[model samples]
Target: MKRRHFAEGAVVAALAQAVAVPAHAQTRPGGAGWVTSWAASVHGPYPVGNPSAQPEQRFLFPSPPDGARDQTLRLVLRPSVWGRRARLRFSNAFGTAPLVLDGVHAGLQLGSATLVAGTNRPVSFAGTGSVTIPPGGQAWSDPVELPFAAEPASPLLAGRKLAVSFHVAGTSGPMTWHAKALQTSYGTAPGAGARGAEEGEDAFPFSTASWFFLDALDMEAPAGTPVVLCLGDSITDGTASTMNGDDRWPDVLARRLNAAVPNRVAVVNAGIGGNQVVGPAEYGPGKPFPGGPSALARLERDVISLSGVTTVVWLEGTNDFSRNGNASLEAVRDGMVEGVKRIRAGVPGVRVVGATVTSALGSSSAAHGHQGQDENRKALNTFIRDGGLFDAVVDFDRATLDPGSGGLRPEMIPESTTGGPGDKLHPNRAGYLAMGSSIDPAAVLPVRR
Candidate 1:
């Protein structure tokens, strides 16, 4: 495989430029703050990474390089916590040319591609309706007040999805996207022109299971609200769980926190399917991997740069031991050590919890189910529990491991999304619930005063 290596310093510098938020935009009146209510970490440019349950996109975007031309996209995402004011982040992290976007709007979703009546609000950047983000860069929109989210702590808004619509002006070159969103989002046909302000679903004739351009959404929240970020690979990304079910372990964790702490906490997932902890030494548009960037490479952009992050749950490393990766066990362990150190340095007083990788011993996937791979996974899990590197540990392995067969529990092996036997690599909805319920909320959340 051909590999292109860019200087790590250069990549970090570029990401730093992309995440630079203006000083005035940091806080709201009376010391209210911004917390990342939702986030989808961007990997490679379009059509280069793994996307689950995706529909054919040749009709929506004929040329991947030319990207979306004069089309509107309505992305559906659920916020862990609701707020009266919110901001959106658009990224061009993997594009080869400037990404020009306009006609942006955010509203409460009534259903597929449609927003609640009188709730669609226009979003602006620096007081303007449109913004141009340079290649390898991103921009955050000015705070847009959400009239529908009057009470941030209201149970009525819990589990409701947010509809963020935006138009891609001209050609987007190579679009930055998160493949494997697992949630269906709507889009207009190419050259259909800007229809983001439309409240109806007629303008969006196509659907995709991925998110493009737009990445992070921040809600104005209380100053001390704790934000728990789950950083890992597909399991954390909800693969094989359910279609539009929001049953990922992080989603379960969020619900747990909401019931225990009310609106005092937020949980965001930053997982990418096929991702590894450190094996892919380099990643960019020229040398893209199906897994996206390595955990170490993306830690800065995905974990450190997000707003109001108080704790991190790191669940990864199974991919690094897979047949495709074949990365040594030491490399994976050290990479995680380095990653945790970076996270602590970037966010002061942040607690980092390590979750053991689950069993893939008898997986149906060709790349997994090897004895050697399972051995490596066990070694890593042992380290996670006894290494004393993390503030806490979540025993996901014990939660789903079947001692009899050395594989996932029998009840957790069947697929829940489209039905059929599962790959045994990624857990099903029941397995995810087992993993989620195993977590002790107090271990990952901030102690009450």
Candidate 2:
């Protein structure tokens, strides 16, 4: 009827190891679990242009599936929730207005691809289901009582399957998603995600650079090191990569961390599509995109507010160099300065890595094209590398800039973007791979004792 998570099999492999250990302060060598891994999960508001078949797009979404449509998409996942606390992430990263939630629920499922009966038990934000996410903001549901939670004594989720589904009702259509999901996400009931409803939920875990908002999904870890959050815009968000390929820069970083290092690090991406450094979306006349959010305004909420975050890789601002997105190098510089300062103030002593806004050679963003925009890009990079506003500088431009045209290489641009939505801007899977490899591996992993 109801189960929290998978308790045996591959997921439970560790249960044996977990048993041999002492209860308190033994401090022995560790293997891999949530604490041993880089992050529990990764996904965000950055929407891919489209993934569903044409029919699905029209028949279901008609337009695009925005947050308001409580289109419940089901995925029969066999992943592990092997920790004490869990998180359910929701996004409004692209909403021009706040994203609202109503009648959200996640529980063990009894069916497979199709549904026979859903618990229909409500999910909540800090215990309440109705959550109103701010424009371009994301929210994570408080971990409800998962019939199947992680067990440290063994491979937490040794062998199991989980079916998680939720409801949303604020913004309708035009939803942002990375890849196609398992279940068909039917549109929300007639009037879900609406603005005014007597039921309202309190705050949950959120971050500007967080891939998706996080909530303490009632779950447990090996009871050691905290999590590390890597916050930024699209590049950090890992768009364009093959679905579930784990190719985003954050994903890449996590793999590297888990493969060898110690310390227990988690890289969470909180990037949004069409995110700007200082303003809302940039649909330069005649171009696509509807709106965007200013990176400066969101840094504190997204980057510093995450749970157990020890570091943040601030990599964003490409959208700011619009026809007029940012006034000048001065504007970009001020934003950077303020954003960094605000984060430092909020987190005190947390290491901030300044990732140079990567170069956008053939960018299709309407804001690009003008020599003025290029000027702003170069100008902002100057500050990122020269201003010394961060503990260390991660140069994304240095890693991916093409030797030929001085923009992203052909390998980097996605087929769809090149298919023409806007060539020159985003990268495809290969490109995301290069972007992922570009980062210095040492900077992110845990320190060896």
Per-residue lDDT tens digits of candidate 2, residues 24-68? 211324532222222222222334332322122333333443433
Name the best candidate (by lDDT).
Answer: 1
Residues 1-449, candidate 1: write the lDDT tens digits.
11122343432332233222223224567868899999999987889888888999999889998998989999999999999999999999999998889999999999989889999999999999999999999999999999999987888898899999999898998889999898999999988888989999999989999999889999998766678899999999988889999999999878766764456578999999999999688899999998999989998899889998878999999999999899999999999999999999888777799999999998889999999999999999999999999999989988888888999988888988778999999899988888887877656765432
At residue 192, give the lDDT of candidate 1: 89
Model 2: weakest 10-residue lDDT segment is: 202-211
Clashes of each: 0, 61
RMSD of each: 8.4, 10.6
